[model samples]
Every structure is written in structure tokens, then in C-alpha cells.
Target: MEAEDFAGAAERKAPHGDRGGEAPRTLPREQLIGRLTQLAGVGNIEEAMRCLSEYVGASRFMLARYDLLQEQGLNFIVTSNWPFDLVRKISGVLADRYSRSTELEKCIALLQPSFEDLPPECRVPPGMSQRYCSLLFCVGRVRFALLLLFPDHMILSQERLREAALLAAYGASFVEGRSQRNDRDFELTEREVECLFWIAEGKTSDEIAVILGISRNTINNYITSVMRKTATKTRSEAIAYAVRNNLV
Candidate 1:
């Protein structure tokens, strides 16, 4: 979904519980589960992005998957704001520097949240602005982030942040398992299942290949086979399916 679409959607869903601009009531655990369950069922990526966008009360959100290789930068599974050109440019810039910060390091190493000040390498083009942006958590092998745009300094309560993180984690898992069966677990080879688990943890294909002692192409092939068996279109969908089915 385009960033512009967020404003309208927020207007429709907003004023629900806002106290002088803060969320009036934090989503209860049951509500959160319901929302995430709904998200798991979304067939369209935009619908999922929009679901996440409103849930977090953010003007924009992005789920970008990064590989450790110096050359192949980040991949955008879903983006709410930040223009395409900017995302490409900033992703390249952020790739090398992410490893330096403790938050980024923890996020990459242990699937933790990197919710800190924006990395210096993230360059906003002329006329662009943001207030708070954070790497919330990683799901499987993907890093999911929450970016709050300018004029909206969302001082997320620790409880709310924690809850959002948990919900985002669920979303990550759901996206990670998107193409798996809804009723039963998809039958995947040992390597494919291993790859699926790590992908949910945000590992790159090369990482999986190395861990499995196989070529990257072979790793990709396994993923492809899994996706075919599950009948998913994108890797995100496959992961979502896996999450829904509790495959990994």
C-alpha cells in the first residue's frame, strides 16, 4: 500500500480510542489475537500491510528482509511509506552500517527488536521527514520495522510497545508461513522445513545454504518446492501459510 493510503484508512479507523492523540485503549490480548488472525487470512499484501499499519497506529510501516552479503541488499516485502526510489537508495546505504549498532546487531543475531534512533545511513530525500522509526523485530528470516512519520511522535507506552512487538512477531510468523496449508501442516523435506524455520527467524537463503551445506540455488529450489506444495505466490505468503498452520 502507498503511504498516502494510510491517511485515509486511519481516518476511517481512528478516533476509536485516542486520548489527546494517544491510543485511547491499548488493544487487549484477545483483540490483538483476533486482529492477527484476521491478518493471517488476508490474500492481498496491501490488505495485510494496511492491517498492520492501523494496528500499530503508525502513518507508515515496512517489512524489509536483508541478506548479510555486502552486495545483495534488502528486499521489500511490504511498504507503507517512503518512496520506491528512496527505499532502494536508503536500503543500500543502511545495509553496511546496520551491523555496527548494538540494536541492529541484536536484531540480526537473535531476532530482537532494534527500536532506536534511525541509523545515520538512512537518508531521507528532499522534503521527506520522520520522527521515530524502529526495527520492531524479525520473523523467521525477515526484519519487520515500524516507522512513524513526522508530526506524529507516537510515544508508545512500554506496555503498548511490548504488546505491539508481540503482535508484530505474530504477524511476522504469519507472513513467514503464508503459503502453508490452513488445516494440516505442509509436507516439506528436512532441509526445506529447516529453511522455513530459519526464514521465519529472518535468515537469508545463503545463510540457509551454508547451514544446510548446500548451494544457494538448492536452497532456493527447496523454498520453491515448498511454496508450490503450499500453493503460495510469494515467499511472504508461504511464510504466512506456515504460521497459520503452525508448520514451524
Candidate 2:
């Protein structure tokens, strides 16, 4: 899908007014933090995301792997309440944006909320905004993005959005950490996981070496180590294992 396709689709979804519904209630920062902390303690990532989304006045939420957006299928999605069709329609645009960005640009986008207009073909729930918000965060070597759909004419709080992103990251880290503990025998070093992430992005060893500023041979060695540790026969199988285990 070309970038122009997204622009044309989004243009048609714009121009809705607020329907005078009661505003979403806002929680005090301290209380919000406390609630999020409790959710994180129990590894309830879905609830944590929902709480944050509501607090920030969004009607829906989608948590996805930023590094795996380019991959086909919804396997990269961790959790979401978005319409399945909407997700499928916009995934290509999101992947295009991710691929065009440099590593430094992506790192700079961490925890920063960005809004994008929904495509025309997407039928958002009544009273919802045509635009959606997204923010990125890292949990270990893996990066995740939280996408939100809000109401029309609602002004979202930037501070709360940043806080929500951080809290979401904390919750995700807690869950990912617990999962990793259960697979301690198959643990890969941080470098190996980094390599896995790039390979999953469809980069060759030489390209990954350039991106990481390391030797191609070193990159290959890392992949070799990852394969051995995961007991996978090929790079494709290793990447599959990483995705299944949420190691990337």
C-alpha cells in the first residue's frame, strides 16, 4: 500500500463535531499512578491499558509491537479492542511509517504521543473521533506502541498521555519479565535479542551490522548464538520462536 492511499482515506473521515456527551472523568495523577501500579503488580496488562486509555479519554486501545509492525498477520499485536477491519486497514500505513524512519528518529519518538487520521473506509463507533493517537515505549529490547481512539472534539491531555505511556510500559515490562523468568533456560542476551528484532524487520546481517555499527561477522555470530540458544535450525525458525515467546 502506498502512502497516498492513507492520505486519501483519512481525508474522507475528517469533519465531525462533538455530540455533547458527558466528558470522561479524569483521575488525579497520584491515584492514577497507584491504580496502574496495582494493575502492573498483578501483570494485568489489558486492564492497565484500558485504565490508562479511559483516564486519557480514549474510547479504544491497541497495543502492538513497534518492531514487528512490518510483519504480516496480527501476531505482532499484543492486545486491542479495535475493530479487526480497522486494524487491518491501517497496519500497512503504520508499517510504512516505521520502515521510512531512521533508528534515531524512532528512539526519539519514545513515549511521545502522535495522532493520525483514520481512513475513510473505517467505520469508527458513533461519537468517536476520526483521528487516533499513538505512543511508543520499550520493554527490554522490544519496543511497543499503544494506539488510542478518542471522541470527536475532545482535547486530550499531553501530560496524561505521556504518563499513560510510561505506566503502560511499566505494566508491559512486568508481564514480559515474568514470562521470561518462566523460560529462563532459553534466555538470550540483550545483543542477541536486538539482532533478532532487526532480522524480524527483514534486514540482512550486513544491513543490521551497519545499523548497529558492528561488523557483519559479529552480527552473524549473534544470530548463530540466538539460533543455538533457541534450538532453532534456521533464521526464520529463530525469528518465529522469538515472536512466539515475545522475546522480540
Q: Quick one: best TM-score, which candidate?
A: 2
For residues 1-248, write the lDDT of model 2, one tens digit per residue. Answer: 22233212212322111125455665666887788778877888888888888877788999998888877787678889998988898898888899999878989999987777877888888888788888899997789999998876665556667777888898788788777523743578888888998898778999999989999999999999888888889999988787777776
Model 2 is weakest, by summed lDDT over 10 consecutive residues, at 10-19
lDDT of each: 0.55, 0.79
Tens-digit lDDT string for candidate 1 (132-217): 44545666544555444333423333334445566666766765666555433536767777777777656789988887888999
lDDT, residue 234, candidate 1: 81
Poorly placed runs, candidate 1 (over 4 Å) = 1-29, 68-74, 99-104, 107-129, 141-143, 146-152, 180-248
List TM-score per model, in order.
Answer: 0.51, 0.81
Best of the candidates, lDDT:
2
- Error at 62, model 2, angstroms: 1.1
**Which stretches of candidate 2 lie above 4 Å from their native place?**
1-23, 181-191, 201-203, 207-214
